[model samples]
Target: MKSKQENITIISIVIVRRFICFFGIAIIFVLNGYAQINELSIELEIVSISKGNYHPSPQELIKGDTFPKRIDFEFIVYNNSNKMLMIGSNTRCYYHSDGKETNYEEIGRFLMINGTDTIPLYTDRYYLHPNPHSSVKAIWGIIDSSKDFKACPIFTPFLKRWTNVGKDNTKELYNYLKSSRFVYVPILADYQRVLDKLNNKSIIDCIIYPRNTLEVKKKEPFSVFVGYLEEKDYDYIYPSEYK
Candidate 1:
């Protein structure tokens, strides 16, 4: 019933609407891809012995016994995307040496700073909320957590007195320091795996939801102090200097 000119105009309107919708969808896809590629940036650096306070002094040296010291590994995570990221407390540190890989699961206690409050990452359910352009530091170490003095009540006094005498070669601390080469430490956001799997699911009621993917910003590894070995000196530096 419409005129030829009116029909042509209607068709043109439909075509323009379709083109606009298609263009908007394409822009969303591009932005989403960019966000996925660079959601979070991670940088790792070795805190020096002096800065980390892990080296011991001469007064704490014991004769003929191996002293235990912790080597600190620091992780700086930055949220590069606009969306808020949820980093799980299940963070892990990997040490690569001589084609062999050793994993150190969250050792001692690590903290996450969100705004003014410092949240401790000790429990299994803890989550870090790093907003856009915000950064958080997660500190881990090669300290032995298996030997709980409280668990061994009978040997508590003896263990406390002879802390520097016993060395567990099978533990993580021994293997971490034994490597002569530069330790390749990678701090991974293990929670990202959960986020990847929940791409299509509704995470509103979920206790732990995924955010942006954590990316490594720096290509090179950051160096840190391992240990000092003096010539003919059997005593090595302990992480904590005993007065």
Candidate 2:
């Protein structure tokens, strides 16, 4: 038999090894749980055009010079998971223009019309619970005419429409606008700890914005409308002409 002192030392070594193994296993479980908790699944579908108009402001219409074309779209968000997901009040969605680095913000205050009542998109925690889904309508684009050098002047007449063939007339422009994808960032209740990890990263160089990795499966196809000014006659014109 081993000496009493030697046996004590061996027992202590065994306890330490078991403790380390338990600790490692625990860590792995924790990380795996984190990954699952952070995961989100949802769907987004562009339903229809809510409004299409060209006018920076009502007061500026007298000048006959419209710089920005505004177009609004109706969209639906469907919850694909069995569990309820929470979207914060300040949640924002961005449109990626033809996979370019430039991103455009979805206009604030998307209203949900529920027959007699109208609800704002943002809530303390927009609980997307199970199957049903939510509908929201808001302005999607405010494209500036100045961005395209070849763009026709806002007040250009219909007879001189041939001169207006530029960036707006290209199939690439239409495809670019149509192919634009939206990235939505919403806070999830189970994955709140992910934000802490983001905070630990280098804040000075990185813009840390958290977005859910919910695959947006489209149930319906959507169309885009281009807004411009059209002159009906030499003396009369339509301020908001959508095509």
Candidate 3:
């Protein structure tokens, strides 16, 4: 048997590796396959955005060693399903954007089509996410997964970060998002396990993005649901301004 110290060391190493997995492109290996039926359809939107080096420590709201030059964002995700969902305390969304742009190149990871341009996003909001991959707080059973279920909307706020954005051009990034009509996809997870009512086997993953399309249409004033994309928008073509 291993000594007490060795056991502790092994446990600590496992924890470190888990956090490191979320740090970069390593997240790609996680399989969030598309599951149809009573799974869940999420409606996501960006509430507010600000640029600075926001440190969570006392008196360091705008500058820190970890996020020295980053863009911070707030998102509201609604379950939008009739059935109750055990939302992972860490439910979050990552913006799927044009990777060729200098602004996005600096952060996140590549999602494979529209996701091809998606970068990983970290929000400073929602402190409930301790084990972002496997920790479910059992929160939001009242979650409005669908208006059909609950007429009113129920949501959770998740503030995330994208560090190393060119601070000077933060406004430019904002403008491009508006012009290009950026898209977002939810990264769902839970601590214990959420059953896939349709699949019979409990699964931690589900897929939503239309793999072939870019430019998920802006839903409502904030953005949610599937929308159309003109063919002109794809295949190296872009708005005249972007060209």
Q: lDDT per residue, candidate 3, 1-243, as tens digits?
A: 889999999999999998887764444532322232223333223322322343545764443222212222333333333333332322222222233433211111111122224333332124322232431122221111121112322221211223332233333334434544333333332222223333433322332221211223333443211111222222221122221
RMSD of each: 15.1, 15.1, 19.5
Backbone clashes in each candidate structure, one number apiece? 1, 0, 21
**What lDDT tens digits, residue by residue, belong to model 2 across residues 27-67?**
98877555533443333343222111334345544332322
After superposition, the stretches of candidate 1 with alpha carbons farther than 4 Å from their true spots are: 1-37, 47-68, 91-127, 130-143, 147-221, 226-243
- Distance from true location, Cα of 232 in model 3, Å: 42
CA-lDDT, candidates in order: 0.38, 0.35, 0.30
- Which is superior by lDDT, 1 or 3? 1
Between prediction 2 and prediction 3, the one with superior lDDT is: 2
TM-score to true structure, per model: 0.33, 0.33, 0.29
Show the lowest summed lDDT stretch of 10 residues, model 2: 158-167
- As a whole number from 0 to 100, the lDDT of residue 122 in candidate 3 is 33
lDDT score for candidate 1 against the true structure: 0.38
Least accurate stretch of 10 residues (summed lDDT) in model 1? 47-56
Scored by lDDT, model 3 comes in at: 0.30
